[model samples]
Target: MKTLLLAESHPPTLEHLTGLLSQAGYTVRAVSDAVMALEHFSADNPDVVVLGVDLPRVDGQHVVHLIRGHSQG
Candidate 1:
C-alpha cells in the first residue's frame, strides 16, 4: 500500500519505522511535521497514514481527522 509516514523528530524511531514499512512493501513518504504531511497528502493521496502523536504544530489525532475528512470527500 502507499503510506504517508508523519515522522517523529527522533531519528532512530523514524528510521526503524521506515525500514519496517519498506520491508512490508509499502511506498512511504516521510514528513517531519503536520504541515509537510498535509502538503504531501494532497499530492501523494496515500492509502494510509502513520502519524506520530508527539508531532509539532499538530498532533496525530488531528492528522487522523484530516485524513478521514479527505477519505469522506
Candidate 2:
C-alpha cells in the first residue's frame, strides 16, 4: 500500500480528497495546517504528497522547503 500526505486548508476539500484517495487504496494522512503537515511528513515519510498553497500556519511553499531540508539533513 502507498502512503499519501495531504495538506489542505479547506475542511470540506480535505475530507473529500481524503475519502477519494482512501478509496483508491492509499493510506492517507490529512491535515489542515502546515505545522501538522510538517509533523506528519517527518513521521510518516509518505510516498506521495498533496499540498494546498493556501494552507494555514506556515503555508505550503515554506513547508516544501522545510521538507526538502529535512530530507537532505
**Among all candidates shown, the one with the greatest lDDT:** 2
- TM-score for every candidate vs. truth? 0.83, 0.94
* Candidate 1: regions farther than 4 A off: 4-6
Clashing residue pairs for model 2: none
Residue-by-residue lDDT tens digits, candidate 2, 6-44 = 999999999999999999999999999999999999899
lDDT of 1 by residue, 3-59 (tens): 655456566888888888898989878877887888888888877778888888988
Weakest 10 consecutive residues, lDDT, candidate 1?
1-10
In angstroms, how far off is 47's CA in candidate 1?
1.2
RMSD from true fold, candidate 1:
1.7
- In candidate 1, which residue pairs clash? none
Give per-residue lDDT, candidate 1, residue 63: 81
